[model samples]
Target: MTKVQTAKDVIEQTKFFHRKLADFYDNLSDNVEKERVKILLEYMSRHHENLAAILDDYESEISERVLDTWFMFVNKKCDLSPFFSASINPDMTAQQVIEIAVDFDQCLLDTYEGILQNEISDEVRDVFRGLLEMEKNEKIKLAKNALKIDSM
Candidate 1:
């Protein structure tokens, strides 16, 4: 995606990130042999799709003034370097995949948190605060599901 300058740009970037992550999980599911891991990856892939849909809703409903407002670029820059540098193979265990997925969720949550800390308007804060809550709740749900999977 292009540079993150406005609120709408950030939403677009986040949507792009979710879509790419879903694709990654889908690819991993196809390459893996374990049925359980495949199912989990598929679930995660669907989860990302849901996130992207939420962003779409936000993009449509966001106030014009807020959408045009510029935001900080430091945290808006999503670095998937750690994820990209690693070697993901068919041999990778389900637990390892779960761990990675959890990390990805945490990173998204952290991004929203960083934005909240920056000096933005109340309108922007309210929008991001809602997103932050959703992210936080999703992380917890994912962790619970991961634990169940780990026990299997």
Candidate 2:
């Protein structure tokens, strides 16, 4: 039998995803040869960490009724390997790192959009909508920062 997931469960899973991305970037930063790439990787690492923390705060502030709402459509196991397995190398330029970072954010944005498309309750929809909006804003911020890094 498939296991049902609550909104809280989804939020927790997303938090874990961000943490894993942060670790990936952190590890890459240590191995990268280019100083600029290293700096961008470190920044990406912190960005993911901050996103996870924001999720924690979001989860805490949400009503239990919304948190406990079951997502019957979200039972499939979340596979994050695609994000980790992207063609990233220590020799990648700052622009390359930024591209990867933006791609990762886009993947996350797609996930939220996918979830929001399901026929969930309004409260649950609202919760995901909020997350989706946050991700969109962060992606723009990351792109702007990438431009700044490129100019350096």
Candidate with the greatest lDDT versus the true structure: 2
Q: Estimate each model's TM-score.
A: 0.87, 0.87
Please give the lDDT score at residue 148 for candidate 2: 81
Per-residue lDDT over 1-152 for candidate 1, one digit per residue giving the tens place of the 0 to 100 score: 22347877767878988898899898888988877788788888898899899889877898899989987745655556646864677777788888787767777877887778888999999988988898788778877876676567
Q: How do the residues 60-151 of candidate 2 rate in per-residue lDDT, one tens digit apiece?
A: 99999999898765333444454758676668898877767776777677777778878899989999999999999988887888778767
Off by over 4 Å in 1: 1-4, 76-79
Clashing pairs in 1: none
How many pairs in model 2 have backbone atoms within 3 A of each other, for residues 3 or more apart or on separate chains, i.e. clashes?
Answer: 0
Alpha-carbon lDDT of model 2? 0.82
Give per-residue lDDT, candidate 1, residue 22.
Answer: 90
Model 2 segments more than 4 A misplaced? 1-4, 74-82
Return the lDDT, model 1, position 15.
Answer: 91
